[model samples]
Target: MRRREFVALTLPSVLVMFGFMLVPLYRTVEWSFERVSYGQAGTFVGLQNYLAALTEPRFGRAVVFTVGLTLVVTVVTICLGYLIATLVNGLGRMRPLVLGILLVSYVIPHVVGAVSFSWLFDSNFGGVANFLLGRLTGGDVLWFTDLWPNRLIIALNVIWSMLPFVMLMILAGLQGVSRETLEAAQIDGAGTLGRHWHVIIPSIRGVLGFAVLISTMDVLRTFDNLIPLAPQAVGLGNESIMLYIYNVAFREGAEDLGLGSAISVLTILIILVLLYPSIRSILKEAKEA
Candidate 1:
């Protein structure tokens, strides 16, 4: 295709991306360096907002909670997703049905799913899960008011929501694994675990890496689920980075927009750092190809 045709075809999309993404990003960065609120002129504040975010004890707790949740959920989801994908891949006729069932959580909106999930544990809502656990362990678990228990439910909710996408990605990767390679590994006396660890995993390293990258980004920005699942997040130290930002910038009686924007910039940097290895590997693979 000619350059003119290429530019014509892509110009609209480029403009749309710039308008929707770059404009907001620029505004956020600008706001981060100024003392601003909604619909008011911002005064220059230099790095004061950033310094405040860094020094705030609540912000520190929010970072620790968010990062810890991201690590736990990402690792657990990848492992469980791979396992479920492997099992589903071996099915012949039931694959579609199994996948459909597994994808129900993924297809549901996060807030709706979280509300439904919370009902399963909230005794005020006649929570079946809490009842069963109480019968089994002889104690009522405080899923909302407590720190660790709330964290567990939040992590579980995140894993539940994210598992299907990861599994589907892995399942797609599994379809591209060579039958000949697997047979050769088996012929070489590799056991099931050995075959997975050596032949299958290495072949799908790129897919797994991509899954991890996406999952990490999603988990880092987790907010919707916490609305219902961790209502007491601020008090219990269960606040995610996004939630903290929301409380600071948008929540009633707290319109510290500059601090929120600073935290947003810092969160972006943290995500980039976390995803650097996976992104570098992808670039290397693309270059080699």
Candidate 2:
């Protein structure tokens, strides 16, 4: 391609990155170095904001929750998504119907799904979750109160909202598995479990790895779905990193844009650091393939 044509084709994307991403990122980093309030920038404070953020008690707690949530969500999403994909793949004629039903949760807007999930476990208002528990265990479970239960609810909501996407990805991967391989395994006296474990899973390793990567990144920045579920966790423990950042930026009269920007920069760094190994592995495999 000619240089002019190449430039013309790439100009729009370049402009978009500058306008939407680069400019905002630049401004945020600048703000991180200065004290800012009420839409006004103050004296430059060097690395004080970063220092304070690192030393914050809430920062430590949020880091713990963020790490814990990412691990749990990634595992559950992969295991359950693969299981559902396998079940749906076996349905043949019923695959579309089952997939459509599973995808309803994914299609709902994030805010609406979060609200719906939050209401389902509302203990005080006798939500459906509590009502079911009442009937079965003779006691309503307060899902939003304790740290463990609240974390569990958050994990469940994350899984519910993300399961469809993971399942769909795995289902697509499953399509690439050869029927002859499964038949060969069966002829060798392999049971259903053995066939899947030895043949089907190996055939879809790359796709499964991609799905796990996506789920990990998504869970790392999770916030909206957790807000209504963990409102009482303002600035304290139990909040994810994103939620903690949100609280810092818009906590009523205590808003600290500089500190928030600092946290945001740190969050981006943390995500890149965490995902670096997976990203490198994927790129290396692609290159070799």
Candidate 3:
């Protein structure tokens, strides 16, 4: 295609992205250096906003929770997703139905998922958690209110929302695995575990790495679901960095856009640091391939 034709095809999207995304991102970074309140911009604050965001005790706790959530969700989602994907991949004809059912949670809106799960697990209500725990332990398990249980609920919510995407990615990778290699491994006296450990997992490490990186990032920035799950205590015990940013940026009466923007910038840097290893592994594998 000619340059004009190419530009004609992509110009609208480019302009839209520039207007909606790049403009706001540029503004956010620029505003991060200012002491802004409401609609008024105060004097240039240098890195004071960033300093405040980093040093804030609540922000510190949120960072810890975000990291912990990311780690736990990453591991759980990868393990469960890979296992489910393997099972789905081996199915002869029911794969579509099974995969579709597995992805039902993903298809639902984040808010709906959050609300549904929250209500079902509400400690006061006669929901699933109360009923099951009532029967099992003859007592209610506090799905919310309690620190550890609330954190566990949030972690489970992230995993439930993320598992389908991870599974699909791994499933696609599994599709590319060499049947000949698996058969050869089996012929060489490798058991089911041995064949998978020696061949399948290695072959799909790139996909696994990518899946893990995506899931980790998603869990780190989880916000919408968290809102419905724990709206009152967003920047508290179990909230992520993004939640804390939201709380600061749009806190009830007065918004602190400057500090929020600074925190957001710091968040991007932290995520980059956290994901460095997985990203490096993926890039190295791509280079080798």
Give the top-scoring candidate (TM-score). Answer: 1
Note the Cα lDDT for every prediction shown: 0.95, 0.87, 0.85
The digit string of per-residue lDDT tens for model 2 on 28-107 reads 89889989886675779999999999999888888889889889988988999899888888797887788789999999
Cα lDDT of model 3 by residue, 171-195, tens digit: 9999999999999999999999998
TM-score of 1: 0.95
Rate residue 161 of model 3 by lDDT: 92
lDDT of 1 by residue, 158-241 (tens): 999999999999999999999999999999999999999999999999899899989989999999999999988889999999
Assess every candidate by TM-score: 0.95, 0.92, 0.90
Cα deviation of 252 in candidate 3 (Å)? Answer: 1.7
**Deviation from truth (RMSD, Å), model 1:** 1.7
User: Candidate 3: lDDT of 123?
Assistant: 55
User: By lDDT, who's the top model here?
Assistant: 1
The runs of at least 3 residues in candidate 1 whose Cα sits more than 4 Å from the true structure, single-residue gaps closed, are: 275-289
RMSD of each: 1.7, 2.2, 2.9
